[model samples]
Target chain A: MLERGEVANSWRHERWDSFRLLTPNWQSRLPGHRYEGPDPDGYMTMAEVTAFIEGFAARSGAPVRTGADVTSVRRAGDGYQVTTGGGEFRCRSVVIASGACNVPVVPPFAGAVPGSVEQLTPFDYRGPAQLPDGGVLVVGASATGVQLAAELRRSGRPVTLSVGEHVRLPRTYRGRDVLWWMDASGVWDQRFDEIDDLTRARRLPSPQLIGTDERTTLDLNALTSMGVEPVGRLAAVRDGRALFSGGLRNVFSLADLKMERLLDTFDAWAREHGRDGEVGPPERFAPTRAPERARLQLDLRGGEIRTIVWATGFRPDYGWLDVPVVDEKGRLRHEGGVVDSPGLYALGLPVLRRRRSTFIHGIESDAREVIDHLATVTLAQRPGA
Target chain B: MTTVANGVNVQALLDAREALKGAPEAAQFVWRASSKWQDGVHSTTRVKEFFGLGQEQEHKSEAVFDADHPEVFAAQDNGITPIEYLLIGLASCLTAGVASVAQNRGIQLRSVEAALEGKHDIRGILGVDSDVRNGFNDIKVTFTIDADASRQDIEALVAQSQKRSAVFDALTNPTDVTVEVA
Candidate 1:
């Protein structure tokens, strides 16, 4: 396998302390793969996660050429020609597991936020001390945004959370972790075909959750109540000032409504299986609503809000791939890991096969499917009498 | 009858502002609402002839309320209930305050939308919990407004409106109520 980054799992090279694997320790690996390292029960840090990936590659004895930085891959004869910064290689099949979060997407107004205010994406964010003296304006209230806002707040920096449309889910609901319910209720087993609106589902934000020692729920309401100034979606930045919309309440309502619907689904499932009694003790976490102001403009030079962290989202970069497997918009077109071009396969995409396809647990299953397809294609193209 | 904007007389508002600037007691106003029970958990409120519009002309609005439950020791589904009216009152009061403050600030507002949500424990209203008060545990008001003003200016206007709103004052403060059999 060819790798682009210096390390195999370069995505884990962040300064975040508590990076919880979405799936628990036991389920966070390939099917036949096992972690013989330390802390098999809890989460792993960045170093630990990197070491784990490196250990996996070593155990499998897979010929991984790291630091190659593949520039382009094109179909050559019956195989493919992969060109990287270092050298070139010919391969029959390729699995694109580079990950979904390759490029950080900042808003267009980021340029107008002024050069005086330090800006950083979660990709390069090391810690709070690295930021300037003044507080921060953390845009996008996704998991990363909330986590950073909370962590920064804990470090004595005032945080203004600009929340938008987000999925609000309790980290632990009904005496069990939410992931457990997702696993037990067969949520991860759902295929792409089962999804009614793939566009909306693909764009849905990761649930508002924080992975701590003991799971804690983090939503806009919770953040606001915890001294975090909640604002609307960022509208624009100009003249050393930032503007925000009055859509905060609407976003909060939508998140609450979605949470209610999700809880209702869980409730129905529990009742159907006669496990309602066990999970019947419902916990109310309704956030207090406040009057939404129309707009907010902050003076960037006013010794307050010295930094801006754009946790908006990410887009995959397929600029290097020279195959016809990608669409006009650069998104890979694949059906259950197999690309339309036959030999090219995609893995670790958000909801590629099942709901957890991009998750650690789901990677193993997706890898198996790709391997099966690769095996079939290789057999068909073998030497004949 | 002279034409008015958003049921507000700007000249009268200016007059009141000026009058209050010189003598604050000159701006004293009183509002009254008379509601009568019609049937099970249903009532009608007649609001008219409020003081301090710079004139004593009669303007009336009749609002009805009906509990959304079966007619027993229970609520009956009819119309907007009292608590819902409370939310409406608070929202409308704050919204009007926002408009007034914006106008006073000379802000050209494009659009203004307000939403209100309140949470109440049914046990309090049902008298099941003697310790619980029969009122909303909390109320949240959200306003989405578009105006050609800076964020600080808009926030200042909202704060000024909240400070000057009569309904806000009444809700936040304790008042004596006299119920007499006449």
Candidate 2:
């Protein structure tokens, strides 16, 4: 395996200071390296995650070359040539596992913001201390955005969180982690092809969840109660002023309604399996609350907000791949991870093969499937025995 | 399963969606209306033709509608006001979506009724209150649906309808509008 840096470089460098695995430690399963640490129910900090991955590398005894930045991958006769910073190697089959989040996606309107306001994506954010001393505007209400907004507010910084469509999920439900119910109910194992709307499902933002000792739910209501002002999606930036949508109420309603449906599914599953007696009674959370009139505009020149952190999500960087597998939108054109090219494959994409494909516990199955396909193709191409 | 439910042609809807995926540009539509002033807060708008499926198409018949404020606004009581037309559009779109989604889900509907209330201060347009909005402060729609499904299922149907309604999206999200004069 070739790595641009040491093993678990992203975990060590990209994540915020307070970052923790969204999944419980118990779910951190690889092919042969199941998490054997104590506190299986607790979340692992970034440092622990890095250590775990490095340990896995050591124990697996896999041949890995660190500091090998791949420059390009192209066809070379019946094989493939991978040119890296270190050297070039030829292989019959190649698996691109660079991961989905390689580049931060900032909107074009971000350029209109006054040069006075500092801008940063989640990729560059470390902690509140790194930000300038003033109010903050965190765009996007995904997991990263909400977490940062809450942390910044608690640190005595006024925060205005601009929310779009977001998935609201509780940390725990009915005396178990929400992830537990999804896993036990077979929701996470749903195949990509089995979904009704594969396009919508794949594009869904990450849920608003936090991994802490308290295991508290961090939703819009929670943010509001924390003194963090909630606003609509950032619509435009004109004349040093930011315009927000007037759809905050509907956005909150949609998220709450979706959460209710998910909980209903869990409840029905529990009843069908006769497991209701074992778990706590089904409970519902308070509906999200919105401002009577959400503010529609904010002047960047007014010195109210010092920094703007964009948690708008990420996209893969495939600039070095000398292939035609990318689409007009820069998305990989693949059926579940099988590229159209005979020997090329992709991994670690959202719902690439299954709903759980992006999770650590899920990669084992995907990796196994890809390796199996590679073996079959290599065997078919071999000379007769 | 039968392709017909609640009088909706489910197979045709699905086929159209599939076919459009291959020719996305054909799905772009331009609906239009031409209005003529009829004096004193009144006007008549006619709808006849639209562009869709990569060509111009016409309605079965040209439909004319009139708009005017009520007598309280010191104008002759003509037809319903223009704001009322917005409510009509939203209601029609959501109702259609509910029926189509119900048909797709194989839920037989007995009856579906909707009541919509649009609360407008009107002071913004009158220039009496600058803080108030000219449009409705908020609109609420309640659906009383009797179907062969449970209460949660019915609620899910309505929610799904709103999720897919184009008018609802346009109302909730911002859209770029340009006005040009020749």
Give each prediction's DockQ, rounded to 2 decimals. 0.02, 0.42
Candidate 1: lDDT over CA atoms? 0.72
Highest TM-score model number = 2
Show the lowest summed lDDT stretch of 10 residues, model 2 chain A: A376-385
Per-residue lDDT of B106-175 in model 1, one digit per residue for the tens? 6777777888788778799778999676876556666788887776566655655665666665554334
What TM-score do all the candidates reach, one by one?
Answer: 0.65, 0.94
Error in Å for residue A283 of model 1: 2.9
Assign candidate 2 its CAPRI class.
acceptable
- Per model, kept true contacts as a fraction are 0.00, 0.32
Poorest 10 consecutive residues of model 2 chain B by lDDT?
B1-10
Error of 1 at A129 (Å): 0.8
lDDT of 1 by residue, A1-385 (tens): 7776655455466445555554445556765566665554455556756776777777788888877898999999767899999988888777888777788889886987767788999887878888877689999888888888987887888888887777788887788777777877777788887996565676778777776656667776677767788877777676787767544554665566557656766777787888867764656667536445433557888878888998898878888888877766567888877888857888988888888887777888778877887887764675570
Where model 1 places Cα greater than 4 Å from the true spot, the runs are A6-8, A14-18, A34-41, A276-280, A291-295, A377-385, B1-182
